[model samples]
Target: MMSSSPESRIASLGLTLPSGATPLANYVPYRKSGHLVFVSGQLPKEVKEDGSAFFHQGKLGESCTVEEGQAAAKACGLNMIAQVDKLKRPAEVISRR
Candidate 1:
């Protein structure tokens, strides 16, 4: 049997790239220097119908529950994937090792 690709896996999980993957503040989503690409400041944010952005708030272990934190983390992961996709690189560049 053929193993599912990363896009298929993400689709099976019901996760999609956020509408806007741009960073909220002034900094760019990623910077590539030589063979290394550095990513920073990807948050759990979604764009609303009115073009406004909603950010997931609350610190983990403080105001956020475990499930909420997990969901936020998932969103952040999606956002990071979106950023990597924008750079024309495959997500498999990140690995378990």
Candidate 2:
């Protein structure tokens, strides 16, 4: 699957990489303090609540289809970008650890 740069690849796919991933938990996606932005862990999930997730706690080759895995992966990536976008600039994020 050779193609242009990542940025262009997404563009060809008719998608734009958001600043970063979106937070799955109650925490905000990103933070802003100075001219920088901080993002959090992002995961892939069906955009609509009505969507279905047939694969969970299973390996891709065994239970999940290549296409299904692809969709989930894309969702995860999108969440990351969404996180970065929410921030006006980078902010320090606190970790539970």
Candidate 3:
């Protein structure tokens, strides 16, 4: 049996992985040491087909509701996965810390 690739899985879900965001500062997004990779915190930003971005940009418990915060977290997860998919061995990812 042939398992679907990560990009295929994402496409099957009717989703597209947006381009990774540029670093806000001088730090790189991820660092790999041996088999372990540490991905930095990512924000909730989705790029549209026209290249505009849709993002939740407010502090939780302040201007954002619980549901909105949850959505933001999900977006962050997607972004992290997108970053991980670029790895040399994406299928080898064991667990996300």
**Which one wins on TM-score?**
3
lDDT of 1 by residue, 7-89 (tens): 79888988777754655689988887766667787787766679787778898999988888887878788877877766665
Q: Cα RMSD for candidate 2?
A: 6.9
TM-score of 3: 0.74
Q: Worst ten-residue run, lDDT, model 1?
A: 88-97
Best by lDDT: 3
Per-residue error for 81 in candidate 1, Å, reads 0.5
For 1-97, candidate 3 gives per-residue lDDT tens digits of 8899788988999877767768889888888987788888577877767978899878899999999999788788789888887788654655456
Error of 3 at 47 (Å): 2.6
* Per-residue accuracy of model 2 over 12-85 as CA lDDT, tens digit each: 88986544533447897655656655555555543454644332234689987898788777776666655654
- lDDT of each prediction vs. the true structure? 0.74, 0.58, 0.81
Which segments of model 3 are wrong by more than 4 Å? Answer: 48-50, 57-63, 91-97
Which rank order by TM-score, best down to worst? 3, 1, 2
| Per-model C-alpha RMSD | 3.2, 6.9, 2.8
Better of 1 and 3 by lDDT: 3
